[model samples]
Target: MPDLASLVTVPALLASVFFFIAGSVGLVRMPDTLTRIHALTKADNIALGLLVVALLPQVGSIADAAKIVAVWIVVQISSGAAAQLMGEVALAERDAASSGPDQRGMAGGRDA
Candidate 1:
């Protein structure tokens, strides 16, 4: 019979792949930058976490599993920060475009 770890690992990995694909689709299909970032970040984060979970059972040592989890955590933090920064920039650009040209040069639509 197949081992329990193998059974668990396979499904988790497959789910992770599914989420990664969903994220890519969202990136292409979303209407705007903010929604795109939201979809991609959320999906990718879950996919990465599931990937880490799948890998934990297969690693040879505790240290290897710890390293995998650490990498996942780091990627999660960095991706979230990057997504927030990108969203902010997109909002700023959108606002700039919506505002009249004369207001665009000024900070916060005021004399600066």
Candidate 2:
């Protein structure tokens, strides 16, 4: 018979895998960079996070759990920052492209 730990770990791992698959599907199907970021960050992060938490029992140490949590937090912050930057850059480029040639240069009597 499987031990309690194994049973728990198996289900948690399965859940994590499902989350990852869902995230991947979202990434493929979602339109726009912003939506993709949402899919990748939230879905994948949650999946990986659950996996880490599930493994905590196996780790058998408070220090390991703390380290995992710290890593998760860092991932959350960095992914959010990256997504924000990507969105900003995409918007800026879109704005610039739609704006056509620089009117400021034309007004200043400089070559565009």
Candidate 3:
């Protein structure tokens, strides 16, 4: 029979792969930038977490496991920040596109 680590690691890795594929699909299939970012970030974060969990049981030492977890944490922070920035830019562009030119105001104001 297979060991406990194999049982845990195999399923977790499979789930991680599933989520990563979901994120990729979302990135391509979503209608808009905001929705795409939403899907990708959410799916990818879960995938990364599962990947870390899968690897933890396989690592040789506590330090190796800790490093894996730390990498996940760092990626979580960076990806969140990047998604936020991209969302802001997308929203700004969307708002600008929706607004009328008159609302933008004249560059020189009322000329005599």
**RMSD of candidates 1 onward, in order:** 4.9, 5.8, 6.0
Best by lDDT: 3
Q: Which of candidates 1 and 2 is the stronger one according to TM-score?
A: 1
Instruction: Tell me the spans in candidate 3 whose CA falls farther than 4 Å from its real position.
Output: 100-112
Quote model 1's TM-score: 0.87
Candidate 3 per-residue lDDT over residues 1-112, each given as its tens digit: 3488889899999999999999999999999999999999999999999999898889988999889988998999999999999999988877765563447764643222
Task: State the weakest 10-residue window (summed lDDT) of model 1.
Answer: 103-112
**C-alpha lDDT of residue 72 in model 1:** 90
The TM-score obtained by model 2 is 0.73
Q: Write the residue-wise lDDT of candidate 1 on 8-68 in tens digits.
A: 7999999999999999999999988999999999999999988998888888899998999
Report how far off residue 16 is in candidate 1 (Å).
0.4
Query: Residue 39, candidate 2: how far off, in angstroms?
Result: 1.1
